[model samples]
Target: MTRTRKAMVLGAAALVSALTLAGCSPAAQNDDSSNATTYTQDEIDKALSTPTELTFWTWVPDVQKEVDLFEAKYPNIKVTVVNTTGGTQQYPKLRAAIKAGEGAPDVAQIEYQYLSSFRQTGSLSDLTQFGADEHKSDYVDWIWNQVADDKGVWAVPQDSGPMGNLYRTDIWAAAGLEGPPSTWDEFAEQAAEIRSKTDSYIADLPGNDPGQMMGLFWQAGAKPFSYDGDKTVSINLNSPEATKVVAFWQDLIQKDLVATDPDFADEWYQGLARGKYASWQVAAWGPLFLQGTAKDTSGLWNAAKLPQWNAGEDVSGNWGGSTDAVLAGSDNQIAAYELAKFINTDEESALLLANDQFLFPTTTATLKNPDFVDQESEFYGGQKVNEFFAGVSTTVDKDFQWLPFMDFVYSSYNETVGAAISDKADMVSALDDWQNAVQEYATQQGFTVQ
Candidate 1:
C-alpha cells in the first residue's frame, strides 16, 4: 500500500524518458556483478570495520533516524540516503542504473508487488544465501512470503498493511449498532441503516484503485494474478471467487448504499472531514493518515477486523507495504544486506520506523510490543487502533501474489473495471473485460499466461 505521502503508481516511460545516460555502451545492461552471498562473522566484522560507503534509496521521510542507528553500530560504513521517487518512478530509475552500470544504490526500498519486477531483471541479490532465510521466523508470515519465492529470498520485510475496518463509532451508535459488522451481510444491513438514519454513506468504493479491489479479491482467497519472475504467469480475474467479490460490490454500488468517489483527492478528503462516509476498509497505515486528513472527525472513529466472508472464519488481505532489497550489482553485498536487515529488524530502528516515520510494523517484535500497540489514539476515540490492526495482521492470507507487471495491471484495471465501477455498469461483464485485457497484455508481454 502506498502511504498517503508516497506516490501510488509507477510509470515506466517516466524512467526511460528521464534518463540522460552518458558514455554508456549498449552492452552495459543488467549489471549482474560478482557480489558475495555468504559471510563469516569475521568477514562481516572486517567488512563493517572497513572504510565503506553505501547508498540507500527510499521514500520514507525521517528515515535518517533509522539509518543513523546502523551507522552508529558500524561506524566505518557511511550510508547516503537518496529520496528515490516511489512506485513507478523508483523502479524505472533503478533499472536504468543497473543498465547504465553505475549510480545504483546498494539498497533500495521496494514495494511487495514491484519486487517481482526487479527480480525479473535479475537485478536483486538473493539475501537467502547470506543468512537472511534464518530471520523468516521473525517476520509476519505473509510479509516473509512476499520477499521469497522458489528462487530465493530477495529482500527484508520492512513494513506491512494488513487490512482492517475503521468506522465512525458515532454513526454506528446512531444506527443502533454497538460494534463493527461481523459479516458482509451485517455490513450491508448497517449500510442501509446508516444511510436511512444518518444520511451518511457506509463507505466510498474508489473506482480508480485496483489495489483496493485486488485486496478484496485476496481476502476472498482469490489468486487472480501470479508470475514466476520470468516467462510463466497466471491470470484469473474472472475466477468464481473473484466473481463473487465483484458481484458483492456491484450490488452495493447499484443500491446507492455507498458512494462512487476516487480517493486521494480533495473531494475524498472533504468526505472524510464532513463525515459523508462512515467507515473505511483501509490498511493499518490509514489511522495516522486519517488523523491528519480528517481532524474534525477526531475521536469519533474506532478500528476492528474486516468483516468475515464465511460465518466464523478470520482472514484479511494486504493493501500496501514495502521491503528493503539489496541490489545485485552492489560491490558491498555484506554491508548492504546488513543495512536492510538492521533498519527493519533492529528494535530501535523498527520502533523509530513505526513511531517516527509512521510505517506500520512488520516484525512480530514490533507488532506485538505494548509500546507500539498499547497506546490509544485520540483520533480513533481512544481506541488502541494499532492493537486492533495487529490482531488483523494475524488473519491475513499468507498466499497472495502479484504480477511482475502490476504497473500495467493497475493501469488497465482503471481503464476497464474502474470505468464500469464509475459508470454503474454491469461489473460482472466488466470483470470479463478486465480478464481479457490483462490476459491479452500478458500474452503481448511474452508471458506464458496460464
Candidate 2:
C-alpha cells in the first residue's frame, strides 16, 4: 500500500525531459490533477441509464461474470471485456494504443508496479473525478494507499498478493520440528539443519523472478526505488538493508543450502510435487497455486508469515496485486468507472471473484466476510488458509514503491543481479552493477534522479 517513505531520488537542475516525449507534459498532468470533476447523484443516474458501451482490458480469466452483474444492474451500459496476455506482454500493447490514439480500452487491469509508469504518461483517468477517495475505507490501508498518491486515485482496488511462507509440516516433523521459524536468523539455522538431515532444501529462491526478491526487500523496509509520480526518480538496490538480503541469500546459495532455480517452469513444478523443497516463500495467491501443483502432498503443507528480520516483528510484503483503472482516453468515463467500481466493491461480485476466481481480495469487507475467510482446506490439514493470509495482508509494509521505468529495470535485473544469482556469484557486487545500470537508464530517460 506504500507509495513511498524515503527520499530516494537525485536532482536535476530542473524537472525535465523524457516523459514529454510520450506527450504527457507537466501542464497536462496539472490539468489532470487540478480538475476533480465531482458529479451529482442525478448526473450519475443519467450516465448509468444512458446507452453507452465500454471496452475493458484485463488478464483475469472468466471475469465476465462480474461484468454481467454490472450490466444487469445498469441495463443501459454494455461492457466488452477483452483479455490480454498478462503484464509483460499486455503493457506494450497498452502503451502502443495510447501512442496511436486508438484501440485502448476504457477500463484496464493494471498491476501496482506498472501504475506509476501509466500515471507518469498521464494515461490513467483520475477516479477522484467521481469521488473515488470516499471509498478509501473499503480496502486495507496499505492496499488502498498503492492506488493513490497526492495526484489522485489512479485505480480501483481489485486483488492483492501479500507474501507468506508455506512449509511442509510433515518434512519438519520428521526432524522433530514443530513449526516455521519466527526470525530469519532462525530460518537460516533451520535451512542448514534441514539440508544436512533431509533430501530437501527448505526452499528454492527464484533466480529469474526479481518480484519475489523485491517482496523480501519490502519486508526488510529497504527503499529500492521511489518516484514522485513526476520527473524525480530514485534507485538504491544496494542499500544497507537491501544488501543484507543479498548477502544473506548469498550465504545460503554458496553453502548449497538453498537452490536458485528459475521459477514457473517444468522442473520447478516437479520440484514442488516431489518435495525437493520443503517450503515456498510465496504470495497469498500461492496457497491455492501450491494446492493444485502439489496435490500428491495434500495435508502435508501449512502456512505462516515470513520470518522477521528481528524477532517479534509482524511485517510482511506484497508480491502481486492489480487494480481496475479507467484510461484517461475513454469517452465512457462514468460507465467505465461504474464497471470498475462494481466488480470490486459490490459484495456479491467481489466475493464471486474470491470464491470462484480465487483472486485474493483487496476489499476489507470481503476479506473480513466469514464465508470468505472461515473455509477449511483439506489440502493443508484443514487449516483456514484464507484467514492466515488475510491477517498477513494487514502486516505488509505500507511505504514500498516502484520505478516509473520498471519495464527496463526488470529486464536489466535478469541480466545483472538475476544472472549473478544463477551463477552463484557475489550478489553484493552484482547489486552495485544493477544500481549503476538503473541510474544510467534513468538519466538517459530524462528523469531527475534522486
Candidate 3:
C-alpha cells in the first residue's frame, strides 16, 4: 500500500484553481515538441556545475541520503527537501502553487495515477527535452511508460509496486493444500478448503480499494482507461475482461470464501496477526509491511505471484509507487532534471531509496543485483522477498494507462463498484454503473469521451 490512500486531492478550492488554469493542459501539448529545444552535453554539464538550489517535495523519510549523493556528484548544486505532508495533501498544494505561479518545487514526487491529473493542469514538464529518453532502458518497461508518452517523458520512475500473493504457509498446510493456487479456479477451491479447515478466510478485499482493483484489472489485461495526452479519453470500465475479474471476486465474497475487510486499518492488522486471513493479495511493499504487523507469524509465511487468469501465465499489476518529476514552469529545468535522474539512476542513490526509504526498486540494475534481491527474510521462512517481487515486476503488463480525472475515477468506484461489493450486489453489473459515472464526469469536464 502507498503512504497515503492516494489522498484526497482536487478539493473545492484546488478544483476551482485547476479550472482557472484550464487549457494549460493537453490543448497546449504541442509545446512538447516545440519546446523540445535540444541541449548539448556541455550545457547540461554547465547547468549542474553552476551554483543552484533545487526544491524537491516528497514524503519519503530520509531521502536526503539519496539526495546527498546527487549533491556530492555536482558540488555546485544544493537541494532542499520538503515534506508535502504526504501524497494525500501534496497534490492540492501543488495545484495551488501552480495557480499562484510560485512556491512550486523544481522537482516533485508524483504518483503514477496522479501524473495525468497534474498533466491535465499542465503542471509537469516534458522531461524528454532533458534527455530522459536516454535512460529508458534502465527502468521496467511498464513503469517507464507511466512517466513517458509519445509527447514527452514526464518523470523518471523511482519505484514500483507489482502485485503478488503473500500467504500463510501453515494455513495452507492445515487445509491440506500444497501452496498458493496457480489459477483462479484452483484459488476458489483452496479458498473453500481453507475456510472449512480454519477460522481464516482466504483473503481480505477492501471495498474501498480502487488501487487494488485497478491492479487486478490490469493483470487481466483490462484496458479500462486511456488518454491521448490531451482532452480525448476512452473510458471502458464495463469491458468483458474487467467484468470477468470482478465477477469472480463477487462470487468469492458472496460464497464467504473471502472477507470484505477494510485494509490498512487496525482490524486488518489484527486479522493478519491472529491468522484470521489465510493470505493477502498484496503488492511488492506488502511483505515488508506484513513483517512489521505480523512479526509473530514470521516463520509461517511465504509469497508467490498473483494467481493467473490462465493456469500457466505469470502476470501481475501495480498498486503503489512514485516518481520524481520536474515542474514544467521551473526555470531550472536542466539542473532539476539532473537531480531527478541522479537520485534514481545512480546505483548508490537508487539502492539507498530501496534500502532506506523502503521504496521498491524500479531500475533494472537494482532489481537484478543479488545484494538487493537475494536477502533471505527470516520473516518469510528465508524467502528472497525482494527477488520474488522483482520477478513479479517483470510480469506486469506494459500498456496500462490512467484517466486524467483519476481522483473522480477512484471516488466513483467507491460509490458504484465499491458500494456494490460492500452490499454483496452484482459485481458484473456494477461495472455498468461505474462506466456511466465515469463517462458522465468526463463529458462534464470538457473531455471528448470515446
Winner by TM-score? 2
Cα lDDT tens digits for candidate 1, 1-450: 212212211232234334524332342222322132344567677888898999999999879889999999999999999987576678888889999999999999999988988888888999865778878889888888899877789999888889988899998999888788999888888889998999799999999999888888889999998888788999999999999988988999999988989999999999988999999999999999999999988889888888888889999999988999999899998899899999999998999899888899999999988889999998887888888888999989999888888888899888888998899889899999999998998899888988
Pairs in clash, predicted candidate 3: none
Tens-digit lDDT track of model 3 for 1-450: 111211122133355456558844333333343355556677788888889989999988888888888888889998999988677789889889999999999999999998998898888888866667878998889999999998889998888999999999999999999989989899999999999998899998888999999999999999999999889999999898898999999999999889988788888889989999989988898888888999999899999889999978888999989999999989889999888888998988888888777789999999998878989999999999999899999999999999988889998998888988888888778889999999999999899998
Please write out the lDDT profile of model 2 over residues 191-230, one tens digit for every residue: 9888988899989987789889889999999989999999
Winner by TM-score between candidate 3 and candidate 2: 2
The lDDT values for all models are 0.86, 0.89, 0.87
Query: How do the candidates rank by TM-score, highest first?
Result: 2, 3, 1
Clash totals in order:
3, 5, 0
Which ranges in model 3 have alpha carbons more than 4 Å from their true place?
Answer: 1-34
Q: Which candidate number maximizes lDDT? A: 2
